[model samples]
Target: MIPQIRSRVLWIVMSGLVLLLASVHLMIGGLDQHEEKSQRLRFLPDGHFLRTASLGYRELTADVLWLQAIQVMGERKVSPEAGRWIYRLLDVVTTIDPKFTWAYEAGGIALCTLVVLPEESNRLLEKGMLHNPEEWKFPFLLSINYAFELGEDAKAAEAMALAAQLPGAPSNLGRLAANFFVSAKAPQQAIDLLSDLYEKTSDPGTKSLLGERLKRVAVERDLQLIEGSIARYRQSHGGLPSRLEDLTTSGILEKLPIEPYGGRYEYDPHSGTVRSSEISERMTLSMKRRRDSL
Candidate 1:
């Protein structure tokens, strides 16, 4: 019985070795053209096959495929069609070895920057995040992909928050995430993230800093709501209100949102804009971006 099992193992090993060699040639057939590459991909074993059919040789097969995938991308110009093939190759590699961290990073950057394939990059990085939950780079990359390529700031902030919570993540990641959340127009999300971070962090300095930023964000949020109400009032009444409370009296706000920093809301009747006396405009993201030369 042992001999029979050994023979079966040998057979599976030999078959896997042969298939691995055949699969390497798959990249040679079509890189310059999408249609041809797509056709050749049909012959290559898919992710499921690599995962389930490798006969315990999945790691070896995965390594070989990873090399081929890298080589294909390095040797070719990475046209749109080639990008798709690269995505497939990477998918197969990651499927075979879910813990392959470098594969995810390489694929994430290459797919996003080399071609207009943010969706593919996002999928690969998200899978990396799923498999390697402790690794911060995957979600960091996802945050970047969502922010710059996809223009989804809320998702970007969420991804950055995930990255920030992991060990070895940059300490400023949470701060960056707050900006993204605010830019996403989701001030509550920013408040929530900062609140959570402030609670978990034991460093008093960090907590104090986060407290200040949290109050500032809260102030910004309330001001944004009040500004919107002011706009509506202007449209209906054709002029600015004399005071912030007028909005509440006019049924625009149930009541003015309290400023978190114990400062009153400043209603500029001339411009019809609301500001928080506690949080300076320079402290807000827009002013920061401008100061930073955005």
Candidate 2:
């Protein structure tokens, strides 16, 4: 009983000493200093190391990190540094769980749309494609990146073709694949693609919007055909035609092309330019007005 009592007292004394030491340490350093140290230590680690540390809970860890990334973005209010960190966080998440399609999709989009980091977005999207080869979203996003960001029509077509091959992808993607073959310069291809999308979509607002796009594309197509015929007539006759009928009269064109907005094709002999009478002023100047809106 004596030995037991002595042992209990010693244990109590030792516990007190340990706590006393911890208190002294905290007092010496100060909470503010400790917090500053912690802040300094909050740097991101390598994603591969994180994945290795996650063991079998990689997906869960990735999800947590993704949430944290989102919170950081929200907190930072889209500062440039936040944009860079978001990519790093997304990379880590995707590295941990390659099969998480939403991470890749959302990450890629944010990187491109919000961050405007095309190269980083393309890298994330391509990585997603490797992991989810059967997913149409990755390739579709890649196609958008190539077409809009990089201005690579052939690459866009390649990606769109991959997307079209996947199940559940919109059927218009196949037609788009063909248009990409024309370097995305053919108005007919754009018109066909828009028509197909319009046909399959069920939303009224979207259909109405697509109707505008269809009309614009049609006008663009008619302008292209008219311009090509005029160019041919110029090449053959060494001058601009006096009127739209001159092309048909000279056998350069079988007949006058139909105007998209139900108006006659207008010819300006002074400037050797062709325009639709019913086209808006913006459309008459450039087709890029609508494209710029995109």
TM-score of each: 0.57, 0.51
- Write one digit per residue (lDDT tens) for candidate 2, span 207-266: 554565467557767777778899998999999999889989999889887875677777
Q: Residue 30, candidate 1: how far off, in angstroms?
A: 7.6
Report the C-alpha lDDT of model 1 over 233-271, residue by residue, as the tens digit.
Answer: 889898888898889899988998877867788877887
Q: How much is the lDDT of residue 202 in candidate 2? A: 74
User: What lDDT does the true structure give each of the candidates?
Assistant: 0.72, 0.68
lDDT of 2: 0.68
- Give the CA lDDT, 0 to 100, for residue 216 in model 2: 57
Error of 2 at 208 (Å): 21
- Candidate 1, residue 275: CA error in Å? 35
